[model samples]
Target chain A: MNCRVLLAQIEPTLGNLSANLEMHLAAIADARARGVQMVLFPELSLSGYFLRDQVAEAALPAGHAILSQLCERSRDVSIGAGFVERGEDGRLYNSYGFFEDGRLLEVHRKVHLVTYGMFDDARDFAPGDRFRCVQSRHGRFGVLICEDMWHVSAAYLHFISNVDALLVPSASPGRGVTQTEEPGLHSVRTWNRMQEALALLFQSWIVYVNRVGSEDGMIFSGGSRVVDPFGRVAAELALLDPGVVETTLSADATRRARVMTPLRRDEKPWLVQRELTRILGQLEE
Target chain B: MNRLDIQCELVEQLLVRFLRSEAGKFGFLRAVVGVSGGVDSAVTAALCARAYGPDNVLGVRLPYKTSSPASEADALAVVQQLGIRTRRIEISAMADGYLAPNEVADRIRRGNVMARARMIVLYDLSAEWRALVIGTSNKTEILLGYSTQFGDAACALNPLGDLYKHQIFQLARHLGLPASVIEKTPTADLFEGQTDEGELGFTYAQADALFERMIDQRCGEEQLVAEGFEREFVRRIAARVALNQYKRLPPVIAKLSERTVNHDFRYLRSWGH
Candidate 1:
């Protein structure tokens, strides 16, 4: 199926849940008015990133009124928004909720908690253990919350599952000033290359939405863009600015890319899995 | 290691945004800067002019008795170029008031006193004007602890902390600053004939090169030596960085309770703002 989608690149007020909720509601209204079928928000759209102790306060339970409010609004446009989820086991998780048809659909928890260099995600939230595909009215999709995209296996698992697109919610900090090259942040360039590679190899669309604004000294760089299955940027927003952008997903383009390359069709997962077991000494054990 | 060079046009946009956003978070739309006629302060003032129009930025020039006259004239040039409001307050009386009674004899003691007196004046005006103080200390000064604690280092926000000294000159030229500021040697203007390099016994370029290798590349002694840095010079620079570390952070609070201010009860200054 082919449909239009909107990326809401917003600057979240630190630790303010109700204010961020209002932001979500306003963006949803705007996207719905534009006839966009899906809306994606950046990681921790409800709770600002760099939440030292604020993670606990920002955690929402499954039956939370806020999530319910979003669910009701998603009847027309499917929504993907990031929040700290309070688990049934009482553990907190960095999770993205995909809602449609006036109900909460699949929720993808961030499996990799970044633990190096200005990141202590593991200290705040528990890790997610599995990668699951989300069935949407617009298209089949996968969710990767920021660091999940850094790991190849996370995107590959969804590729194996045959998703049409991967929605990545990122709150990455802006860093590294470009000197000899064009005027831009180095981190953003690195992110662009990774998205292109993942899109081309997996033969899937990459919808990357990053947030803007600063939390203390850390500035979240906003260069949200959608890459087509052929590894080309279809649309993008400006860097370090809060803005919304739109792009279209088409079945025809995906079909053309895959039909020409046939990389996925030629893939052998069972053989690879067996080899992985051998490499990991599982067969010997 | 990353290149020390910066895209000046890009940095100008980012610093402008940083000044506005960080200041706005605290309900401030006006900025106050202590313009010292140096490239660092001049570039900072230029960014401030762009962030909160010239009408909202107040450039205060605090001059001591021993300060170079050219310093004052060059500072005026910067203020005139940006069209920002300017104020000149002679700080000789304020500094001598304490120095006379305390008999502060050492040059280091007198310099520290003068630096801190300016800080007191800036913070007081920040309250009167209802504006935040924007700092001008760059990465080189901050990394080497070459600033006074709670003195020249005190500010509500610092957009230039991440930039190196070379980048400051790069930005100054990009801002179209007066040649007097961009080409002159940098000094704190605390005493007569005291330049930063002369006092530190080394050049800023040397320090920048050493740090780019030693800190950014995570190079050890052997690696640094292999990279052409003198082993003795590396040790001396590293010692300076380690010794001056206190000036770079907030006062360390002892943990007496389960949740302390900078310990378990950690949160950013702009947490709720």
Candidate 2:
């Protein structure tokens, strides 16, 4: 039961909704051409990242005409990307949208609103309070945004669920690799190490896609990658361009790995409930 | 929505235009930047590279004896990942030879000396490479006067002058910079264990958000608190942004003429020609 996925590191122009959508469409078409069943893109791929107050006004319904066209265009591929979704209550959520078979499958709003380091997710958009797995012909998948993955308290719960793979749509900033003269080179290596460690610890396939190019003064390094259940990097795309790297997930391998390491047995569902309660309480306040 | 889109598109379009226009006037195709393995410099370098080209982007890693190897590695990593040429110059001897003092005094002066030394190296490279020196100071740091005025702050062009710390992060992610560099806490690396967040007494997230609400939205204290913000945090941030406003503007000068340098009417250097 091997499933192929594509990590599309597409360059997005901030706030150019039409252009960004076109880029995603091209990437989705390419993913289908490459026989990728699922393709992941960065957070806010539709409207771009850090859009200020404009995020509120830019919010669109999942059933919008343009989105419908995108779903129709990407009918063959399971496309996951970030966008500003307008919820029923009219509150905008930083959402991960799933499109498959010419239909909108699901929309998972980011729960942890990152209020730090240039992110005002809490200020403009409301946090998502639900976590549910999307059942697909390929496998059960859990989707999260950039900060949602880093929120270990929430990620641990998502990992403990019956999901076969984890997909992250991110718009992460670039830092200096070390402390030196290589302005273009990354001096830091902790984040990459963390991704590998997380994949190994969770024993689930991971797909991470990021945006490239500068907006305002921020730089996003597009080191989009796919990690196997064995925690090995299956494919890695370059930084600063629109790139696509496709690879398959062996359903047999994932099942075998989960069985051999059945660490979920030790995971306490009660603890997750308690943690979610606390997090929810804080958000409500 | 259209206005916002137009503004965003204009920011990039005009930025490219301005950088090219400036370069055309100077006859330099590339730029040299000193990335401290921090977000600001990393973003600045990315912009210069995008505005020019990776081949035209030269990064200089100037490290003092006390500087961490991680800083040097991070700098080199960015250069390699971004596909830019680089030069690593150790400034220990330069600092030691220029400043002759007791150990304590030597240490105190070393930080400033190191900064000046790094600028010297950058200027030298800018000349040799026939490139412009790109500045990395953001609006927040510049507003707070948190940067060394003439050292790391000296540059031919600063693409990030209008952005705050948080905005820089947003743009950084959009640029697809190196991930390792994107996640670390920013620091001056002037001394060991000196983090920008810790010294600033506020996280960039909090500071930048507060700036937006207060300055951009023109919200009052009551509205800010009603929005679920902490009272003390708002007070501190309000004070910080207000006090730092002066740093974000040009140095004041006496209006000696009807057309003063920066006050009445202004023109580019081309006006003099």
Candidate 3:
């Protein structure tokens, strides 16, 4: 399957849901006119990142009217957007809603919440307990939030689950100086390297979208990119600028890359499981 | 351009845009800066001139009676180079009125009085000129709490608060500042013959390197020492940074209600505007 995808790099206003939803709608309409079949937005794009104690107020149910409208309008273009999801248990989650054919297809909550410098996601969100690839009209793909793909296990699981593409939404801050003599973006360079490595390792397309603009002193470097199965950057947006990057992805390329590399092939899941059990048995003894 | 040059250009552009946007948000298109014939003030004056045209920036030189004549000449050079308006006010009487009456002999107390006197003049000029007072303190000085509270630290908006001292020199050179100004020893000019490094007991280059490792790189003291920094110097710098935490923050308010100023009731500087 060959499909055109768009990474929407947007600057979201903190704690402004209607304004952000309008931005998303405008981006979707613009992407649709450009013949994009799939549109991916950054993590927490609906409510903006760094909400602190305001996360609860920004949380929306999966069946919110704005999300429903997005799903209803996604008949021709499938849309994947991040929002603060108010779980049924009254907890909040950083979730991505995948919509297609006038229906909400999959809701993937971010499993790994960052709790380091300038981040307090773990304090405000309940981590999702599971990870699974969802089948879409285009192909089977997996969705991961920022920091989730940093773990090798997450990438390995996604590859073993046979995902054609991995969509990652991030709100990474810009830091450090660039090495090159040119005016290159450092955070963007680091992110591109990581995404390319993951794409090459998994032999699957990787779409990474990040938010832009400064929010209360933190500058989000919006260098959204699309990496092909062969680890080549198909398309990239500029840093610290709100824009969209459209690129065509070929599922056949993933198939060919997997065959050429064969890193995913000749796998022994049962043997690894047996060895894990024997190690556990020995530890028990 | 090299990486440092590129970074300098990027930062200059960003700071210019930021200053303009921030000033516009506050319904002001004019900026007032206190130029002390130092690189930090020179860079701030240049940025302000670029942000709000040279015609809109006013450089005020508040000097004391004992201030060096070279300081005044250097400040005048910046005014002529940038083609911005300037005013010179002698504040020796204003500072001495408080100091001389008490027969103050303490150097720090006299310095603090002079610093506050300069700020008083700047704020008055800001009101008269209808311009926001731009800050000149760099990140190294801010981190070290080398600034006098409510004096050199007071500003409507600070463009150089994030740039380290060494970076300020680079930016000044990039902005085509006069060599005399950039090469001069950085001093608060609080007293004659008082240099910043002499007071701090360390050069800005050394402090900047240690700051890069400890603050930016998040290296511990042991790691910094192992990385070739003197342990005593590292410990002293760390202690200074820790002890000066109060200087970097706003006055701690007792939370007596559900909301208090700078607490739950906090808002952006341009919240209403």
Q: What is the C-alpha RMSD of each candidate to the true structure, in Å?
A: 1.4, 15.4, 3.6
Measured against the true two-chain complex, the DockQ scores of the candidates, in the order shown, are: 0.70, 0.04, 0.29
Candidate numbers sorted by TM-score from highest down: 1, 3, 2
| Candidate 1 CAPRI level | medium
Best model number under TM-score: 1
Model 3, range B1-273, lDDT digits (tens) per residue? 322223777677667756875677557999999998989999999999998999999999988988888888999999889999999998999988989989998989888888899999999988998889999998899999999999989998888887788789889998998999999998888888999999999999889888878887799978988999999999899999999999888899999998888877634453322
lDDT by residue for model 1 over A1-285, one digit each (tens)? 697999999998898899999999999999999999999999999888888788898899998999999999999999999999999999999999999999999899999999998799998999999999998989899899999999999999999999999999999988888485655787888999999999999999999999999887788889999999999999999998999999898888899999999989999999889899888897577
Could you give the CAPRI-style class of model 2? Answer: incorrect
Among residues 3 or more apart in sequence or in different chains, the pairs in candidate 1 whose N, CA or C atoms overlap within 3 Å are: none
Error of 2 at A257 (Å): 1.8
lDDT of 3: 0.86
- Across A95-159, the per-residue lDDT of candidate 3 in tens digits comes to 99889999989999989899987787888899998788878888888898988988867877888
List lDDT for all candidates, in order: 0.91, 0.74, 0.86
lDDT of 2 at A264: 69
lDDT of 2 by residue, B60-143 (tens): 788888788787788877777788777778888877777655453643366677788889889998989899898888867775
Q: How does candidate 1 score on lDDT?
A: 0.91
The i-RMS of candidate 3 is 4.5
Candidate 1: tens digits of C-alpha lDDT, residues B1-273 = 247888888788777888878899889999999999999899989999999999999999999988899999999999999999989998999999999998998998898998899999999999999999999899999999998888899999999998888888888888899998999989888888989999999999999888877776788989999989999999999999999988887789988987888888878787875
